[model samples]
Target: MERLCFGIDIGGTSVKLGLFTENGNLLDKWEIPTRREDSGSHILEDVAATVKKKIADDNLVRENIIGIGIGVPGPVTEDGTVINCVNLGWGIFNVSEETEKLTGFKTRVGNDANVAALGEMWQGGGRGYKNLIMVTLGTGVGGGVILNGEILTGSNGAAGEIGHITVNPSEEDKCNCGRPGCLEQFASATGIVKEAKRLLDKSKEPSKLREIQHLSAKAIFDCAKEGDALANELVEELCRYLALALSHIAHVVDPEAFVIGGGVSKAGTMLTDLTKKFYENNVLFALKNKDFKLAELGNDAGIYGSAKLIIGK
Candidate 1:
């Protein structure tokens, strides 16, 4: 039988599972809606059973399945315990132990953002780059860092938190982590909408964005493309903040490249071009040579990263 491995990514609304060959070829992939009850035990059970059923259906032997790797949304302890996951309603979980016991396979776990970074390093935009950073901008901003071709989980397994970095220390905007003025507070999709609303409320500029009662970052981008001056200005400001955060990251990590991922990245080259311009303008002279690229794998980075973890140290 061919050697294969299981990679699972647990999200608040859904779970993505993939079967992969030893070399990182995605053999099969599937998803299940996440059922958020009180704990993550049932979720683990669901994942184990799903993988076992798939193995049996494919006539694959247990030994041929090398291991399992999981990516959770919240902070994970060094030894694989989930400390807290507000999105999943999980607290102090032994995810690795649970999955191993349920599936009879060696299992490892890491934070979703970290795993996604590993994924990018393995086969996405960061592929071929020894050191890289992945910045994911969505409902909230999230990031992962890879150094020397390995994911850096820090001493507490909670490093690479680029989103929580303070942009304007004096500006107070609440972050999901309960902090104020985090980069996510102004650079994420939600952040863009928040900024757009602030602009509209202030009536600072005439904008077609007013037509959409429930404005989203994507809508703002659309409006900008249609020559909405306010939308364009908002996009510029958002990109400026993103560049500020990235400039800080550049000075510290000094990674070879910075990869921007998530839903907002789908804004395509428009976001990238503006981000590049701002990053160059903001970063210190010593760090001006770094490349900024968009994440190529899009949504699949997590699963790919999980698979990379299972492939071993």
Candidate 2:
């Protein structure tokens, strides 16, 4: 019988699950609402029940299953102990152990961002590259680092926290992490809007961005493409800070490529092109040639990487 595996990506709003063949073909996928009540105690139960139902509905033999792999929204140790998941109302706990007990199958777990990186490396933009860095720029910045074909979890499982890197120590505004001058403060979608507003507040330059009351990063990029000087300046500043952050990372990990993902990545080549130009200009000569590509898997990267964790692909 052909073996199958389960990949689960648990997020704040819902849990994304995928059934995949041993060879990494996605056979089925679905989602369930995350019940955050009671410290998220019902989450694993719900997942296990869904898996059992899926197995029965598909008439699949449980013995042919490899194992379950999960991606959590927080730092997870090598042993599957999640240190804390604020969105899930979870504190430090052995996720694999509990999940195995609930589902009667061996399980492996990883941080969601790291798992997404693995997915990209296995089947997405980072395919063919063993060492890569994935930067997710959404409301905030998130990152994952892969080195020598493995996720760099570090001692505390916080190795890929590129957002918290201090880029402007003099800035008085605090990041969501309660610190000032983080890369997230200037490189994320929210950061772009913030920077645009700041620049507009201080400068007399007129542009289309001044007309939009509900400004977004996409609007700024669009205006930049349409020849808005202020918007172009915002993009330049965004790319400069992002490139500076990546340059620092390049010197440390020296990854072969940087995969840019998240909502902001929808700006497409406009974003990557500018960021790449600045990155090449700022990084060491040896690292200037590193590739910068947008993420290909979209929201499914987490599940793909989660499956790879158990299947060893």
Candidate 3:
């Protein structure tokens, strides 16, 4: 029988699972609800049972299966101990050990964002580049750093938490991370809307943005594309913050490229163009003109990255 492995990405709402060949071809993919209640106690068991059922349904021999790779939304130690996963109501524990016990398969776990970057590096936008940073701009900003084809998981397993990087020091409002002026506070989808509303409330500038009752980040980008002055200004500001964050990161990692993903990235070339323009303006001279590609894997990036934990590494 062909060799196989499991890739699981555990989110607050659902768990995405993929079965893949040892080399990286996804054979099957599915999702199971994350039983986050009761401290998410049922999550691993449910996932294990699902995998076992899948294997039995296919009549695959257990000996041919490689192992399991998992991605969670928190810092994970080198040995698979999850330091804390507030979103999943999980405390410090050896997740890989627990998963291995439940599923009877060797296990590895990494932070979801970091694994996503690895996925991009292996088969998505970061393909052909061994070193890169993944910038995920969603409800909040998330990032992953990959160096020489491996994850740079830092001393505390928090090397890629780029969202919390401070961008301003004087802002009164605090980010969810309890810090003021974090990069996510100014660059994420929520941040873009907050900035849009702030601009609308603070300025009397006549633009189409005032016509919409419920503004969204997409709407802002759409209006900017349509040449609305205030909306364009907002997009410019958003890209400025995003590119500024990448510039700071580039000085440290100096990766081959930066892959931008998440819901906000749907803005497409407009977002990347402005971000690249600004990023090139401020980044180190040696790092100027680095490649900036849009993330190609979409939501599947985590699963692919999780699989890479088993397949490539």
Listed per model in order, the count of residue pairs whose N, CA or C atoms clash below 3 Å is 0, 0, 0
* TM per candidate: 0.94, 0.98, 0.98
Model 2 residue 286 CA deviation in Å: 1.5
lDDT of 1 by residue, 209-260 (tens): 8889889889999988888999999999888988898888788888898889
List of clashing residue pairs for candidate 3: none
Query: Positional deviation of 183 in candidate 2, in angstroms?
Result: 0.9
lDDT of 3 by residue, 189-252 (tens): 9998999989989999899999999999899999999999999999998899888889999998
lDDT of 2 by residue, 235-307 (tens): 9988899999999999998999999999999999999999999999887788988889999999999999999
Candidate 1 residues lying further than 4 Å off, grouped into runs, are none
| lDDT head-to-head 2 vs 3, winner | 2
Question: Model 2 TM-score?
Answer: 0.98
**Pairs in clash, predicted candidate 2:** none
